[model samples]
Target: MAASALISPAIHAVRSASAIVCKEVIDSHVLRIDGYSRLKHMMHGKYIRSGDFHAGGHAWRLLYYPNGSQLQFQDHIAVYLQLASRDPNDEQVLARPRFSLLDQLGNPALPHDCGMHRFSY
Candidate 1:
């Protein structure tokens, strides 16, 4: 019967979503995403957060071609993965994926801002 009563549910939902948000940036060029991370990326749009990511000891690089000219990209790196919490009892897990970069003597610019790089798919 009152305005306060009608608006109670909306306020509750905002609070709920706020409580679940998480983010962290441990290093200058690395990020650690948590279990609650979600992100929507745009080239020149407002940053939609990616909940949590792991970027420790991780580096970025570039790719080149024979005739020269950097490998252009519309989407720098876009991937989606759903992972569960690790189990103490579960052993023999594989190592995290690796990233590499190389420098070019001439032709083709590098991506990822590395001095030089080699990228593999």
Candidate 2:
């Protein structure tokens, strides 16, 4: 089966679960890593967090790992999306946003829909 065919259900599920309306399949914001070789060496064994970027009307950032954080994923790189800004009173602040890694050719390196959570806030 094609990648798009495989990911359609996941996207639909995220929309239904989070009530998140996306104008596009993936969000427009892209995080590019240029000098990864030197960066990882400089900040050894520590996570690199990006500056705040807007997504779903809230601030979000990419937490990157040059070296994996745990033993299980030590040989592989890991990245996480963190909710950078929040309001206790905001209902739509915490959302189940999908994350994906795109190759240099713009193909998704992994499955598109990686997260599906029901946020109480």
Candidate 3:
């Protein structure tokens, strides 16, 4: 089996001048799994991570699980966004991460997409 996914990051920034203002920066990356069936059998709870990608001045990666992260949900697949960059002060990084399964034609599989989750790291 083979699978593909799109991971999009939406970063929210707040700027304070005479008045406070907010902005958003959106970026995305595609992750392709060539041998998903083999991975599912070989890697259970463990995950395959994507190479470092950048968004909103921070480095990020996608954690793909062939099976679920936990035993109870083993029948399902899971994906997570991880912060790959390290800050000297260990400041938290905030982002809204969206995960979508791609169709055979490389478009998003509607209704099969995961909702955006607020992530802080």
Error of 1 at 105 (Å): 50
- Let me know the TM-score candidate 1 reaches against the reference structure: 0.17
Instruction: Write the residue-wise lDDT of candidate 3 on 48-86 in tens digits.
Output: 899999987888998988898999999888888898888
Which candidate should be chosen as best, given TM-score against the real structure?
3
| Candidate 2 lDDT, 1-121, residue by residue in tens | 6556445534444343446675533355677888977776665567888888976666778788887777676556677777777667675543556656788898767755655654432
* TM-score result, candidate 3: 0.73
Off-target runs (Cα >4 Å) in candidate 2 are 1-26, 118-121
Candidate 1 backbone overlaps, count: 14
Score candidate 2 by lDDT.
0.68
What is the Cα root-mean-square deviation between model 1 and the actual structure?
19.6
Clashing pairs in 2: none
Please say which candidate is ahead in TM-score: 2 or 3.
3
Against the hidden reference, what TM-scores do the models get?
0.17, 0.62, 0.73
Highest-lDDT candidate: 3
